[model samples]
Target: MLGAVVAVNLLDAGYAPYRGLFAVNIALVLGLWLVLPWSRGHRGRRLASPAFLVATFALGLTGSAGTHVPLTLLAIANVAFVFGMRMAAAILAGQAALMSAIPLAVGRPMADVLREVGFLVVFAAFVLGMVASVLRARQLAERVRELTVAQERGRMAAEMHDSIGHHLTVIKMGLENAERFRDRRPEAAWDEVRQAKELTAAALADARRWVRALRPLALDGHLGSAALERLADSFSGTGVAVSFDVTGTERLLGPDTELVLYRVLQEGLTNALRHAGARFVRGSLAFEKGKVVLVVADDGKGHGQGRGFGLSSLAERVEALGGTLSSGNAARGFELRAELPA
Candidate 1:
């Protein structure tokens, strides 16, 4: 509709109606073609589609260059085709140079035409820069997300290794003890058998906890003190001093913010325990100064010297919320601070 309005305005401004219609049609067709499935990842299809689009756009712009269709439009179409199609970039650049110089062919003043040419160069350069920036940002975000998922899986596996694997190792030791004393001390052997049974039960419980940790928790809308307390309680037996601090009174934080905040805390605490070698950890959440601040600190050795999944996942979650995560050695020890807008 906006394009149609612009086309009509151009016609009212003395450009021919046929030229206005042609320009509108070119814009509409290009928009539709860019949305096609083939445009997503298939390089070949992208190249062909944009080539046709640029060709049609060039025809329309060339037909009404000085009237309604500006020289910048020609440059823009060229740039779009250049980026969207692999080989088309150079082709469009050359085409734009030739077409923008067409005014010189028609006996027009070089100075007047040079003005549009200058604007075209600036506009094309700006668009190209914006496109490059957006593409780079998207690429970085994708890499972060990939690393986040990989880190989650690694954390889950480590938990399994620490819990279930440790239990299995203990059971093997108990079996060896019982076998050595089988004849000499049958009663002692019986005790080892019982110990193995107890170990099996504990291992099963660890397995359940591991599975629960993998499953996502459905958060309540209340976002109350009770919810935070329950989360703290779940980590009570993990040999870590876990705490929850809520400065602002409990109220319903919108679902998106609540979910992101919970995940951030979970990832941060998991990192402190698994990587920081800290026996005691503190988790705090406060709403102040028009922002929600979450801090997870540990008195253990700071973030490991190498990259890990926990930090990656935490960073991804923090960034997704338009927030930031800071990790450094606090006065007592290592600390992670995550801040998000309320």
Candidate 2:
């Protein structure tokens, strides 16, 4: 609409030379083609700001003596939409000064020039202010969306820790009792084994339910211990002897701390399986006086210079929980370790 108004005014006034009018028309058409969202090609999107600014200046200079200041004002408003308020203001001020000076240099009435420039300046300022407000609102909306997602994730993690972790704790206790009494009290041991099997089935059902609801779960306390045991068992079928050992008394840790430790073990074991090609893997979890420590090592090819996605994710998770993770070549293999406050 603005472009059409400016074009009609330029045609009616017929103040510019034919060549100057032609150049302005070409610039206007090209600028609009690049600036309009639907018409803008990928490369044109990148070049739109500079192209529009040049086109606006050309239109103002060519039609300096005509009653087409509206074209220049429209250009300033378009620039405000593309750039920040300060940049848009600077461009508008420069264009207004040049347009006003061109008319005065040609002996146009000073009062007329001042009136035209003042009108353009005021309208451009209003447009720039409106654009800035819209931009700020958009930024606030985006921040709200980010906070919403984080809250949902925290809630899901808590739910998973409560339900799944409780089930895993039951399974782990049942299995430990079964192992302790297998020879001395076979019947009691068998009962405990059956109960553990049932708990495992229940855990699987809970996992499916949570997955269907699109929720996240965190590893916590007994759940982390069970997960480490299961990870070791998985490698047993691959002809790789995996051993898991724990030192110090068992103690409960925060959900975040447990989850990070579990992830560190998981990533370490995965790297050993995929990259190390080891025949033996050793994993350990230790609860010390003031901290918890986890280590996974494999008698395989040593560590590489670059870390993969899993290792990088483990590092980030541990760091976020105020812990430290290290991975390097050990004397006889590769080792990954993590230490966290108790």
Best by lDDT: 2
lDDT of 2 by residue, 1-342 (tens): 445545654665565455467565656756575554311234447456656556555654455434345555555555555555676688877878886888899999999989988887787777777777877886796796577457546755786787789999999999999999999999999999999999898787657545533412232333656656765565565556889998999787876676577556656765675568798999999999989999999999887787755566668767867888888899988999999988
TM-score of each: 0.53, 0.52
- Mark the regions of model 2 whose C-alpha exceeds 4 Å error after superposition: 3-44, 61-71, 208-342
Worst 10 residues of 2 by lDDT: 213-222
lDDT per model, in order? 0.64, 0.70
lDDT of 2: 0.70
